[model samples]
Target: MDTPSSSPYGTYVIAVRGFVAPFEIGVYAHEHGRRQRLRIDLRLTVRRTAPRFTDDVATVLSYEGLVAALETLSEGPHIQLLESLADRIGDLCLSDPRVVEAEVSIEKPHVFPQIDAAGVTIAYRR
Candidate 1:
C-alpha cells in the first residue's frame, strides 16, 4: 500500500515541541479534580506542490494554525487517556488537505518524581 512517507510529492515538515499546558487528563482517581502540566510535541508532514518563493502566508502551511487547532482541542471536554488525546491531535493535523502524516506525543511531566515524564506517542497518515 502507498504510504504518506512514500508519496511522490515533495514533503514539508512542520514541528512544535515543548509545548506545555495545563490539562485535565488521566483515569486514576487522584488524577481527577485538577489540571496537570502536560507537554505536547507534534511533527507534521505535508505534501506540497513544490518549493517557491512567496511572501504570502496563505500559500504555505502555518504553524499558527496548528497551535490554534491544539488550543481548540484543549478547550474541549476533559480527556481521560493519552492515546485519545494523541488521536485527537492526529485528526486535527490531518484535517488539512495538504497534511499527509502526523506524529504526536503527550507527556505528563509531574506524574512521578523518579522519572522525567510518562506519556504516549502516536502516528497517523492519510
Candidate 2:
C-alpha cells in the first residue's frame, strides 16, 4: 500500500491569470494622465510544508491573499515601467517562505492595435 511517509515531498501551484487592473503608469505622453488596463498573470511554485492533504485553507497558499495584495499594489502611486511592476509582484509572491519560484507577466493590450499586447515577463527563484 502507498503511504504518506513513503513519499514525503509535495508541491502545489497558486495562480492568478488574466487579472486585469487599471494602472496609471507609462513613459509616453499619451499614457500620461489616464489609467490603462493592465493584465497581470502570476504563478507561484510552492513546496508543501506537510505531506498530508489537510484540506484546510490555512495550510495552503491562498490566491485570495495574493489577489488582495495585488489589488493593493495596483492602488499605489503611478509606476514608470512594466518591469518595475513585475518586480514588485515577484517580491510579493516570494515573501512566503514556501514559495520556490515566482513567474510574473504584465501586458498592455491597448498600447497598439497592430499587436495583441506588449509588456514584460519576469521570473524569481530562491
Candidate 3:
C-alpha cells in the first residue's frame, strides 16, 4: 500500500486545445485574409492534491477560466505577430495559483502567401 507521503510523482497537466480566434495578422495589404484564425493550445502544470483529495472542481484551476481569458484577449486589436499572442497566453495561464508552468502555441493556418500552413509556438514557466 502506498501512503500519500510515498505516492508516485504528483502533478497535473491540463491541456486546452483548438481555440480559434480571428485576427488581422499580416505585413502587407494584399497579404490580409478575411480573418486569420489562431488556434491556441495550452498545457498547464498544476498541483495534484486538490482534485485528488477533495474531488472538487473549484479547488483546482478551471479550464473554462483559462479559455475565457484567452477568448477575451483574442477579441482585442489585431496582433501583428503570433509570438506576441503566444506570450500573452502563456502569461495568462501562469497567472493562476495552480499553474506552475505553461506551453502556448498560436497557429495561423492558410496565412502564408504560398505555404499550406504557417505559424508560431512559444513556451513559458513560473
Candidate 4:
C-alpha cells in the first residue's frame, strides 16, 4: 500500500473538491446581510518519510481535519475577497508539518447571472 509518508514523489496528495456552502462574503454594498453560495477546492501535497501499515488515525492526515479547519475559518469574520480567503486557507493547510504544499480555490457561484462562477486559486509551499 502507498502510505501518505512514502510516495513515489516523496509526497502524496489529498484533495477536497466542490465543497459548496453559503457564507457571508463580498465587498459589494448589496452583498452584505445575506449569505452567498461559495465553493472551496483544496489540494494538499504532504511529505512522507516511509510507508507503514498502521491502524492509528494519527499516523496519517485526515480529510475531516481539513474540512474542520475550513469550517473554522468560515465561521469567523466575513471575508471580503476570494483571494484573501484562498490565501488564508493555504496558510491553514501549511500549518501541518507534514504538508509541504497547498492549492486553494474559492469561488462565488452567484456573482453574476451570466457567469457560472467567480473565484480565485492560490498555491502555497513550505
Candidate 5:
C-alpha cells in the first residue's frame, strides 16, 4: 500500500479522503462559468520533526490549515482540467517540509450519466 509505515521516507501519515467541494472547472461549453462538486482524495506521508510526538500542533501538519487552503483553492480562479486541480493539490501538500510524498485525486462525479465520475490522480515526492 506504500503507506508511511512501509515507506522509508516517512514515519506517519495525514490524509483527506472523500472531500467534496463546489469548484469551477472543466473544458466544455456547458461547464464554463459553472460550479460543480468535486470529490477530492489526498494522502500525505510525513516525517516527525520531534524526537517524540507531543500535544503541540507544531509537531505535525495542521489539518485545519490544509483544509482551509483546499477550500480557498476551490473558490479561487477557474481551472480548466482535473489534472491541473490534482497537481495544484500536490503542490499544496508538498509545501509542508514534513511531507515526504503526496498523492492527490480529483473527481467530477455528476458530469456524465453512464459513469460515476471523471478524474485525475497525481503524485509528488520531495
Candidate 6:
C-alpha cells in the first residue's frame, strides 16, 4: 500500500476507508501521553469511462498504494487537529493525476465523555 498517487478516472470517484490507526492527534496533555484510535475516510473523485473501457490498471488509482501512503502518515508525529490532518490527506489525494477532488474525514470516537461520538472532517478540491 505504499506508492505515489495515480488516477485512472475519466470521470469516477472512489470511497475508501482505512480503519483505526492509533495516533497522538490532539492538543490536550492527556491526549499526547498515549495514542488514540483514529478512522480515516476518503472520497476520491475521478473519471469513470477512460480506464474502465481501456482495461488498463494504470489508467486508474491504486487503492492499495493510497492506503499504504496514508498509513505512513499516521505513523509519524502527532498532529494537533483533525483539520490539519484532513488537509494533508486531501493534498495527498490530489497527488494522483486522475483525481479532480477529494474529501477527507478523520474521526476520533468518544472524544467527549458525555457525547456518543465526535471528530473532524475536511474537504479539498483541485
TM-score on alpha carbons, each prediction: 0.89, 0.90, 0.79, 0.86, 0.88, 0.83
Worst 10 residues of 3 by lDDT: 2-11
Q: How would you encode candidate 3's per-residue C-alpha lDDT over 18-66 as one tens digit per residue? A: 8887766666775455566677788887756533557677776789988
lDDT of 6 by residue, 1-126 (tens): 422233343466688885568877899998886888888888888745454456767766868777887889878897898888888888888887667778888788888899756777777766
Most accurate candidate by lDDT: 2
lDDT of 2 by residue, 46-80 (tens): 88778676999988889999889988988888888
Our tally of clashes for model 1 stands at: 0
Estimate candidate 5's RMSD in Å. Answer: 3.9
- The best candidate by TM-score is 2
What residue runs in model 2 are displaced by over 4 Å at the alpha carbon? 1-8
Clashing pairs in 5: none
Alpha-carbon local distance difference test for all models: 0.84, 0.86, 0.72, 0.82, 0.83, 0.76
TM-score winner, 3 or 5: 5
Over 4 Å off in model 3, which ranges? Answer: 1-9, 30-34, 49-51
lDDT of 6: 0.76
Spell out the clash pairs found in candidate 6.
Answer: 1-68, 8-59, 8-60, 9-47, 10-47, 11-47, 11-48, 12-46, 12-47, 12-48
Which regions of candidate 6 are displaced past 4 Å?
A: 1-10, 48-51
lDDT of 2 at 62: 91
**Which lDDT tens digits does candidate 5 get at residues 17-119?**
8888899998888888988999998888888655677898877787778788889998988888898888888888988877888889888996779999988
lDDT (0-100) at residue 3 of candidate 5?
48
Question: Which is superior by TM-score, 1 or 4?
Answer: 1
Given candidate 3, what's the lDDT at residue 17?
Answer: 87
Off-target runs (Cα >4 Å) in candidate 4 are 1-9, 53-55
User: Once model 4 is optimally superposed onto the true structure by TM-score, how far is the C-alpha of residue 32 displaced, in angstroms?
Assistant: 1.6
